[model samples]
Target: MEVEGLSVVYKRARDRAGAPDAAAVRDVSFSLPAGQTLALVGESGSGKSSVAMAILSYLPAGARREARVLRLGPHDLLAAGEGDLRRLRGRRIAAVYQNPGMALNPSLSIGRQVAEILEVHLSLPRAEALRETERLLGEVQIREPRAVMDLFAHQISGGMQQRVSIAMAMALEPALIVLDEPTTALDVTVQRQTMDLLADLQRRRGTSYLLITHDIHLASVHAHEIAVMRAGEIVETGTYAQLRDDARHPYTRQLLGSVLAKDPRPEARPGAPAILKVEGLEHGFSKAKRGRPAVEDVSLVIKAGETLGLVGESGSGKTTIGKLICGIHDRQAGAIELNGRALPTQFDRRGPSDRGAIRMVFQSPDATLNPAHTIGAILRRALAIAGAGDPKAEAAALMERVRLPAALESRRPAELSGGQKQRVAIARAFASSPRLVVLDEPTSALDASVQKEILALLVELQKERTVGYLLITHDLDVVAEMAHHVAVLKAGRIVETGATRRILSAPEHGYTRELLASRLVPPAATAPARPGAARDAPWSAVSQLA
Candidate 1:
């Protein structure tokens, strides 16, 4: 596959007359050789997805694309009609999206979904397709393929859903697969397993890959070549070693610098009073599901101005513990104390002061922010709920404190950038001047640079307000940089707990070791080598060894 001088522009109806139309992708060019990977690394809005859409001829309506040369195998993507592109898409070219839960049909059984792909693409009969679907699921390392076939997507784990999506994509053995932030939503261990599966599949099938992501470290580990993009253009392109050792572009250097930089903020003052504490926490979604409590005897503490990171894989109860602390979920058995006072188990039972003092920020601001209301309105409402003296003035001050411009106050969340929206969320969380905040995977969806900025802001705010933080995330790098202490969770149990540096540098638990090993280390810190060679093994073999 090859592309040259590719440019894409979104024709917005709001554009002023005679104004210059900015292109989302400006003169982007790259080539992917068979059986190799080319990673497009950039921040959000950097046009990596635009390039993918252009290649697949899947751009949205009102979007215009042009290229001097665009060729995929023998077909000219530029010249291909909708019918031609449709046929080529699932047969020779395929795509795996960021969130498999959204990609897979929640209403359909996993078996039927994968079987339908086989039936449509390969013209197999229902029986043959169903049989093939099971084989494909097994190939992707999903256990009890037959059992999974009967279950819907919602019944399965996120990692399984992703594997099902990949199984569909791999059904026809496509020549080029576009992985658009494929593993971003997964936990570290699951992410490593997923990537390893992809690598092994590529090795066996000799399929080329176009990996689009904001993580330069991930690109360095997985791709044969790396392209750094910023503001819709490729600023630098080279092997990881070349770019890491000598990055000519300042943006490229900035991106590298932002990858898990050591937290420079002063440590929390020694002997600071404990702001939040949990003891003997236990919660279960269903008593019928024996031996698997959602949260089992979880316990941790956070002092004023300090962060306690809870690290684990999906379904390890990190978020469950956060919800329990925030009073969003009622714990079956536990004691939660804020400033030495026992808190209610349910959010509705909590007093106004209790509610105001313990706030939570979610992973996606898009889900939390109201589209119909302005940023000022959102902040003001939060302030009003907290019974602030003056909502209007406090709203503006909150925006300013979060480093957002006052002009954005009148704009709705849809009008703000992702980072800006997150800042607004943070500001709202602080509206009550809470003593503690439960941050649940707050920066997982953001780009590396934006993530660093957000973390820095959190540190600054913690220092200023002396607020304690319960940081729940799957990224160990984040734990290394943000947390003063760490707790490792597996199967809904705390397996290890210690200082951040000690847990990351020398973990005692096998699960913690696996999580650390899976994280993508910056190229400068590790020996120059590709990850594919080491990871090129069938998932069955790897899982058995585990």
Candidate 2:
């Protein structure tokens, strides 16, 4: 597969007679040899995805695509008719997107979803397709293929769903597979295993891959060749070693410098008062059918101006613990104390002041922030609830604190970028002037540069307001940098707890060791003694333009 001089432009909605068009991809060129991987590395909206879609003939509606040459094996994708493109899409060229849940059919049985691909593309009999589906699942290293086939998409773990997506993509032994941020949503252990699975599949099937991601470390470890893109153009291209040792471009160098970098903030003072405390916390969905607790005897403390990171794999009860702290979930057996006073188990029982003191920033801002309301309206509502003297002034101040533009207040959530929406969420959380905030994977879904900015913002806010943070995340590196203390959770239990540096440097528990080992460290750096050894793309002015 090959592409040369690819350009994509989208016409924006015209309030006036003439509005400037957006160029998503411009003059981009790359080639992937059969059975090899070519990684496209950049921040969000850097044209990596646009290039992939151009090759797949899946550009968004009303977007104009122009390329000097675009070829997939023997087919000319640029000149192919719609019917031909449709026939080739699933049979020869396939794609696996960032979120498997969005792609998989939740209502359909996993077997039926996998089999439908074969039945439609290969015209296989139902029985034959079902058998093939089971075989494919097994090939993807899924145990109990038959049992899993009968389960719905939501019934399985995120890792399993992602593997199923990969299986479906490889159902017809496609020549190329487009993996767009495939492992971003997964846990560290799951991500490592999934990448290993992809490597194994590529070796066995001789399948070429176009891996699009903002994670440069992932690309360095996984791809044969890496391409660094910025502002819709490829600025650098080479092997990991070639680029790492001496990055010609300033942007590339910045990206390399941000990897595994340590937090720049000073240490928290000793003996800070515990703002929030949990004792013997235990909770489960069902009392009658429970084998193990959803959160088992979990106890933790968060001091003022400190961050206590809860790190674990999916279903490890990290989010549950966060919800328990914020009074979102009732604790069956536990004691929660805020400022030396026992707090109510349910949010409804909590007074307005109690509720205001413990605001939460949900992971998905889109779900929390109403799309129908403008940014200003959202902040104003929070201010009204908090009883701020001046709602409008306070809202503007909150936006300024998050480093968001004043004009953004008029735009709705849909008009903002992921980072911008997150900033708005942070602003809303701060509107109540909370002493403690439950931040659930606040930067997990964002690009690395944007993640850094958000982290910095959180740290700055902590310093100024002395707000405690209950940060729940799967990224160990983030835990290392942000958290004052760390807790390793598994099967709804706390397996280990200690200082962040000590836990990261030398973990006592085997599970903790496994978690650290599973981190996506670059092969070139045996041990990143300092930060920035395995950094993602560097912060760029152009990156914020997204």
Candidate 3:
């Protein structure tokens, strides 16, 4: 399969009148070698995902995509009929998305889904399909293939689901597979394993890959060729070493320099005792039927003005543990102590004192905030809850702390960008001058420059008063920036714990090493959506939901 001078584009609202014309992707020309991966690296919306979506024949619900030429070997892609495209889809080209849980059908067992794909694309009998499915699952390194196949998508861990997605894509053994942020949701070790698996597959099957991601390190490690896109154009295309050694674009340089290399807070002056402590922390979901613990036997301590970094992959129980601490979820077992006093596990059961003393800033800033709630209301709610200051004064002060405009309080949460929402969350988290703040993926959603600003803000906050942070995140760079103490969590267990410098710079566990390797920050990476593209692209009625 090969593509030459391939250009694909789309308009979000072609179906509606007065809708602006937005070109999602444009003038993107590249080739797919028989076995090598041509990675498209860029920030979000850089058209890297757009290119993959186009190649998959799955543009957003409504978008006008124009491609000069989309060819698979001797066959013309853009010209293929619906039936012809369908025939070639699973049999010739398969896609492995970033979130496999969302992609997989929840009601069906893993074995059934894999078998169905095989039956559809390979025309195999059900019994033979089941046998092949087990082999496929085993090939992806899923332990107890029989058990995994019997379980539904909701029953399996995120890493296993991702591996199953890879297996499904490879079941038919397509010539091309597009991996869209394939390892974005996993811990460092899981990410490394997935990358290795993809590389190994390419070596054996000679399948071509089009990897779309923002992690320059992942691209450098896995891809044979790299395309740096900005706005809707390719700014540079070469080997990772080529771009790394002598990058030419300012945007590229910014990405490379934005690493925010980590060192423990130099002005470290330790004070205060344990700000928060949990003994035998355990929790799980289930009231109607039998259930298993998501987080079991978890215990940790955080000192005043220190950051306790809890690092783990998706579904590693890191977020669950943070939620348990934050009062979002009820703790099934264990004692949560704040300032040496035990607090109620349930959020609603917790008294006003608990609410005021321990606060939480959630992971998904967008999801945590209400679209209709104005920034003022968000901050004011905290002020009102804790009765900290005059509502108006506190609102104004909070905005100032987050470096946001005071007037934005009138605007709803939807009006703010990812970075802005995060600041707003931080402002609200600190509204009552809480003793301890649980920051989950605080800087994951922000741009590199914006991340620097947020990290610097945290430093200022720590210096101003006694505040502790239980920062649960998958980002290693962030751990380096803000964490004083670090605890690595894997599969609901703390595998390693030490000072931030010791754990991150020189990891002892194999899992820690893999995370570091997968997380090596590259000085530069490709651009997204081509450089200088309008942030607000032409709108279509069929915009992406969530």
Candidate 4:
């Protein structure tokens, strides 16, 4: 596959100055033979993903208005008609994404989703499709393939859903596939496994890949070669050893530098009072089929004016516990107390005033916001609910707090970007002026550069307000930088817990240690912190790793 003289650009309206919109891609050039992998790496708008999508012949119709030349697998993608290209996808090539929600049909069962692909692409009969789907699931190491297939997309866990997507992608055994941040949203072990699976498949089937991602270190783990893109062009391309050993481009060095930067837990005084606490917490959902609980017998704590990071694989009850505390989900059996008060195990029983102390920020800001309402109204409602002072004034203040312009108030949710929506969500969460905030992977939806800005904003908020944070995430690297306390949960149990310093530096539990190692940044950069006036940086505990 090769792309030559590619020149994709976009034209947008200009101000009185009348300057043309910048080119989204420019004179991009690259080629890959069969049985090898190449990566396109850059920031959100850098056109890395666009090049891959263009190569895969899957650029959305609207984007074709700008693409100049794109060729792949015996077809000139820049000129392929809709019908011709539609027939090519999933037969000779396929693509997987960071989010399963984007690719998997929400209402369909896993069995039907996987089976239909094989049926459509490979001309398999119904019985044969079912058998092939099962085998495919097994090939990806999905436990309980039979029962898992019967489950709905939402019924299965995120990791399993990812595996299902992979199984479907591999069903046709295509000559090549494009993976766009396939494991970005998963935990360390799951990421390691996914990479292992991809490696094994490439060896077994000789399937070439054009992997698009922002992760620099892991690029070394999988690809035979890497092509770093910047400003819509390939600035650097070399083998893992060649690039890491001789990283020349300033941008390439920055990307590598990021991997080794120490993200010590969010700064907080070690002696500060506890902001949130839980004792013998228990929560469970009714099983559709039988005895297992969705979340069972979990316990944890969060210090006042500090961040408590919750670490767990998907469906390991990390988010559920966060939800239970914030009154988003009912707890079947448990005790929940905020700031030492006796609260219900469930939200319904919790008093109106009590609920005001804790707030939740969901992952998908787009789905959570009301499309019809303006940004101001959404935040205003949150302030009103929590009885914050001068709701309108607070809403405007919140917009500023999240680093968003108050002028965006009149625009509806549709007019906003993903990062903007999340900024609004954070503003809403803080609108109540809650003592504690439940951040449910707030930055996961953003790209690397945007992610840093959000994290910096979050730390600023914590420092200013002295609010506690219950940070629930699958990404441990985030925890290393953001949490003052660490709780590693696996299979509905607290596998490890302690001071952020001790836990991360000298984890006693095997799981905790593995999590730390996965998130471990190589030793190179010094701690970048504001050095709060509150106290010394007691929570900056990289020594735990040392």
Q: Can you rank all candidates by TM-score, best first?
A: 1, 2, 3, 4
* Cα lDDT tens digits for candidate 4, 1-546: 666656555555444246665577777766766767777777767787777666665555445434444556777766778787777788767888988866799888899999998777778898999998889999999988989989898877677778888888888888778999988877777787787788778778877788888776566656666778787877877665566668878888777655523546645776777767786766667656375576767777777778888888777888888888877787777777677886776677777777777888888898899999999899888888887769888888778778888789999987887788888988887776788999998787776656667777888898888889989887766776688778888877788887777876788988777766655232222321111111221211000000
Task: Show pairs that collide, candidate 4.
Answer: 263-481, 274-304, 275-303, 275-304, 505-544, 505-545
Give per-residue CA lDDT, model 3, range 1-546, as digits (tens). Answer: 444444555554545667766666666677765776777877766778878877777877656566666787666888898898899887889999988999999989999999999898789999999999999998888999988989999988778989999999999888999999998777666777888888777778988888988766567667766777777677777666666778877777766566676566442456668888988998877666455477888999998888889998877799898888888888888998988888887888878878877878876788888788888887888799878659888789879977998778899887677778889988888887888888888876565666777888987897687688898988888888888888888878788888888886789998877677776544334532212222243211111111
Residue 468's lDDT in candidate 3: 88
The model with the greatest lDDT is 1
In terms of lDDT, model 1 sits at: 0.88
Question: What is the lDDT for 308 in model 3?
Answer: 89
The CA lDDT of each predicted structure is 0.88, 0.87, 0.78, 0.75
TM-score each candidate.
0.92, 0.91, 0.86, 0.81
Q: What does candidate 1's lDDT look like per residue over 1-546, in tens digits?
A: 888888899875674666666689988777777888888999899899999999988888889999988998998988989889878988999999999999999889999998988888789999999999999999999999999999999999899889999999999999999999999999888888999899999999999899999998788888877888888888888778778888888999999888875542335689999988899999999878877789988888899989999988888899999999998888999899999999989899989999999999999999999999999999999999999999999999999999999999899999999999999999999999999999999999999889999998998998889999999999888887789898999989999998887787788989888888887765554555465443332211000000
Which stretches of candidate 4 lie above 4 Å from their native place?
7-24, 65-69, 73-88, 101-138, 143-156, 229-263, 287-289, 344-353, 385-394, 513-546
Find the candidate with the highest TM-score and give its number: 1
- Those runs of model 2 whose alpha carbons end farther than 4 Å from true positions after fitting are 14-17, 262-267, 287-289, 525-546
Show the lowest summed lDDT stretch of 10 residues, model 1.
Answer: 537-546
Top-down lDDT ranking? 1, 2, 3, 4
- Candidate 3 CA-lDDT value: 0.78
What TM-score, to 2 decimals, does candidate 1 have?
0.92
